[model samples]
Target: MIIAQQKPIKEIAAMIADCKKVLLAGCQGCVAVCLAGGDKETEILASALRIMRKLEGNPLEAVTYAATRQCDPEYIVPMDDLVKDVDAVISLACGVGVQYVAERYPDKWVVPALDTKFIGGSTVHGVWEEKCGLCGECILHRTGGICPIIRCSKSILNGPCGGSQYGKCEVSKDVDCAWQLIYDRMKALGRLDKMMEIQMPKDWSKSRDGGPRRAVREDVIIE
Candidate 1:
């Protein structure tokens, strides 16, 4: 899932300082799971902003709303009626969700409330760790299910680079060496022979080098 963190309240306030009325839009998706931009979070932010503005004698009117998913057009359509009179909208979703809301309401000013983190999963309450690089290619078949692209500091395909020591990364002792982890995993699985296969250089073109990418299902498309 896409991970994100909410922006500072001061920064958010500055973004819509000129507006008297604004909408705080939240997503009940990944951001919600991460506890950054959910229904509860949206209401909290709105209340905080209202209190702060009121104390300052500006008195902002912040309306809170949430969608099943801000990234989906269908889920964001309901916000149109609520946003019609607001001067700006603060989206509490990832980059995709913010853009979706902006694209759906072209005339309304749309602002992001969260900083999109990465493709990761929650390790514990309030802690998320990146596990994937989303490189548009998959090579877990050879690496014992460990991702070298994201886990390796240098993204080395054939590594335990010279920097590895005591199964830890040179970048930091707290970090595990990606290749070392792979070697150990493969060894335990009796697939150590697979580690000997020289990996070819990764194809960069399959990644974000060109521009935005799209995956279309022709069979599912509506004529």
Candidate 2:
């Protein structure tokens, strides 16, 4: 899951000050889990924006809506009518959602309400720690499912970097060394020998370097 944190209210307030009408959109996916831009959060932000505008003596019309997903075109279709009437749109979804809205309605101004943080999962309520870096290649199979790209400070694939001490990362004492977890996991599964395998330098083309990556299923396509 991708975790995101909401932007400051003041910054959001500034973005829509010039617009007489604005739409505040939220997502029910990743942002919902992080408690940043869920349906409820969207209403909260709308209400706050209204209050702030009144306080600044520049009251403007604001509306809130939560979509099934901002990433999918089907989910965003419903907002076409609403977006057409608004001067700008403030999306509380991830970065992808903000861009999707802009792409679909190229004329409407779109602003992000949340800062896309990282790909991670919730370990506890309201606590989302990053676990993956989406580095084009996944080595989790041989690393006992722990991702070194996100956990390790340097993203060393082979083994624990010399900087690890007492199971903690040298970059930050609060962070556990990613390679340490990988080492223990491989040892328990009797696959520690796999660590000796060399990995070729990652091909940048597969990542964002070349262009947007896509997945196609020829069998699923029907004319």
Candidate 3:
């Protein structure tokens, strides 16, 4: 899932200070799971903004609203009425969600309340680790399910780099060598022979180098 972290209260408050009334919009998707932006978070942020404004003698009016997903046009269309009335919108979702809302509204002042992190999963109750780099190419088949592109410090496609020592990465002692993990996994699975095969250079055109990507299924489209 896409991970995100909330921006500081002071920063968020400063962004909407010019407006007398602002809308705090939250998303119930990825941000909700990360505890950055959700229904409860939106309400709490609205209250905090109100308190801050009140203490400053500005007394700003803030409203809280949540959508099933800010990334989807279907969910965002429902907020048209609420967004049209507010002076500005504080979107408590990922960067993608923020952009989606801005593109949908076009005229409304939309601001992000969270910094989009990366494609990762929760390792523990509060710990989230980066998993995929979204490099436009997936090579998990030969790597024993371990992603060297994301886990390695230097995204080496073949094997461990010279920086690998004692099964740890040269960048940090806490970091394990990605290729080492791949080797062990492959060895355990009796697939070590796969590693001998040389991998071709990644095709950069398929990635962000070309620009924004679009995936469309003709069968799913309704004329």
Best by TM-score: 1
Listed in order, each prediction's TM-score against the native is 0.97, 0.94, 0.96
Q: Which candidate comes out best when scored by lDDT?
A: 1
Global lDDT of each model? 0.92, 0.88, 0.90
- Stretches > 4 Å off in candidate 1: none
Window of ten residues with lowest summed lDDT in model 2: 201-210
What C-alpha root-mean-square deviation, in Å, does candidate 3 show against the real structure?
1.1
lDDT of 3 by residue, 1-223 (tens): 8999888999998898899999889999999998889998899999999999999999989988899999887898888888887999999989888999999988888999998999999999788989898878787888898898889999878769899999999999999999999999999999899888877888877777868888899999989
lDDT of 1 by residue, 1-223 (tens): 8889989999999999999999999999999998999999999999999999999999999999999999889999888889999999999999999999999989988999999998999788888988898888899989999998999999888798899999999999988998999999999999999988877888877778747889889999989
lDDT for each residue of candidate 2 in 112-211, tens digit (9 for 90 to 100): 9999999999999978899888878776786889988778888776658788999898899999999998888888999988888877876767767868
Candidate achieving higher lDDT, 2 or 3: 3
Residue pairs in collision within model 2: none
Ranking by lDDT: 1, 3, 2
Off by over 4 Å in 3: none
